[model samples]
Target: MIRNPSWVLRSYPSGMPTVGNWMLEDRPIPEATKGELLAKTLWLSVDPYMRGRISQAKNYATGFGVGDLMSGGGVGEVIKSESPDFKPGDIVVSDYFGWQPFTTIPASSAKLVAATDAPVEASLSFLGMPGLTAYFALLKTGDPKEGETVLISAASGGVGQIAGQIARIKGLDPVAVAGTDAKLEWCKQLGYRECVNHRTSADLVADVAAACPNGVDLFIDNTAGPIHDAAMLNLNTFGRVVVVGTVALADRFDQPDIGLRHLRKTLIARARIEGFLLDDHESEFETAKADLLSWFKQGLFETREDVIEGIEAVPYAFVRMMNGENFGKQLVKL
Candidate 1:
């Protein structure tokens, strides 16, 4: 039997997780039972949302229990099957899978990934959760109109990149806010009309205001700290805010973070702010995926991925992503 190495939660993290928070353990690989398939993992995703799962605090999703096998979205090739629906060499993707070399999953639970000109890794990033998140949040929540200004936070990140591009496609002007120069440059290349350095800008409010002279009509917020506050201050009379992620609250969700109170601004602007979780829009996945794939094939959409080799790198890769050290979608290749 092949030995499968899996990353398991070693402890609940108090702050940013380290290697000490995880343990790589080996276990005997087993054959698939009836109606199941055995898969060899090829790509595993590490996202900011995973940070919330490791914490004890209540999040939009359930938290991972201590000593549980760390699981997330992954792409794999079927190595063995006991079901008629799958055969050897079939490619499949799962939103629930372990960070391991191999996994035995029920055939019905995994989805088939059709062959495409784009790399299969896209299934975990742009074409997967991140892309889906961007599509739904921008189209449904933010709802940008033609010629309107859309501002995106964490603009070089997985969902942010796609969010900006989708806004541009829908005839809105996209302005980006990023932490680093390289990330700002990436936002520029993705067709952002202006990029603000939220990390170094002396007066973030003024900086965002200058970047968006007409005021922000739509705000797609991935980080919810200073950027959100500044966006709130610059909202148009009929603006919309879609709070999709909270990277700014990483490792600090247990504590209340004080910032500008924007109630008066929302009240006067007549703006709407809503929290968006992707799972709430499962019915919209097919429509979003089709639109994203079409734009991607037409060269209007593209993605950047930061990949680390080997399953052993999952812990460090996740930490790097959580710390905003990864420039794009972060993944581990086994």
Candidate 2:
């Protein structure tokens, strides 16, 4: 019998999740049923969205219950199959079952990843949810125009990095704010018009304002605390703000967020602020994948995946990502 190791939620975290909150278990791998196929995980993704899942508070999606298997996006190889649609050795991606070495899922639920000229890992990162989030949010929500100033927070992260690059491709002036000098420099190399080290900048708002002399026309906010406030202050008339991920509020989502109220600024500038989720834009996934892959193939876009070996590192990777220690997309390679 195959020894299948998995990570399960031990308890709901009040704030940032600790390694203690997760428990590892080993169980015999179950066989695929009549309509199900067994998949062995090859790669597991740790993302900011998972932070919200471990909390007790009810989100748009149900929170992980105590002792429940932690689930996220995972790329796996089908080992045993009872369904004709899937054969052994087929690579697939699923969002329903993860944090486990092996999973038995319905054949219809798992998506078969086609053999691409590019790295298959790209199917899980830039050509995956993060890229889709960047595409639809920037195009449909932000509605950026040529020569418009686009400001992206958490600019070196999985989603923000792509958003800024997409903005540049659309002929917009992309300015980014990241925590470290290395991240800022990376963003600059990614073709950002300007990149600011928000952590080192003496005056973050002033820095952002100086970067965008004409003011921010499109703002994709990933960390929505001080960065969001700074973006709000510099928003021009009819500006658009797409609220993607709120890393700044990662630990404090349970409590009331007290900060500079941007209600007056929104009213004055007639700016629009809207929250975005990839699940809401499922229909646009193909379009997004096509554009991202085309750019990637043409050498017009690029991204880095910070991969660590072993499933044992999943919890630590999640925690580190929450602290903004990850320079790119955080992944666990089994």
Which parts of model 2 are misplaced by more than 4 Å? none
- Indicate the worst ten consecutive residues by lDDT in candidate 2: 115-124
> What is the per-residue lDDT of model 2 for residues 62-127, given as tens digits with 9 covering 90 to 100?
888899888888888999999999899999877765687888777877888877767777777898
- Over all chains combined, what TM-score does candidate 2 have? 0.96
Task: Tell me the lDDT of candidate 1.
Answer: 0.88
For candidate 1, lDDT tens digit of each residue in 137-222?
Answer: 99887777889999999898989999989888888999999989999998889899999998899999999999999999999989
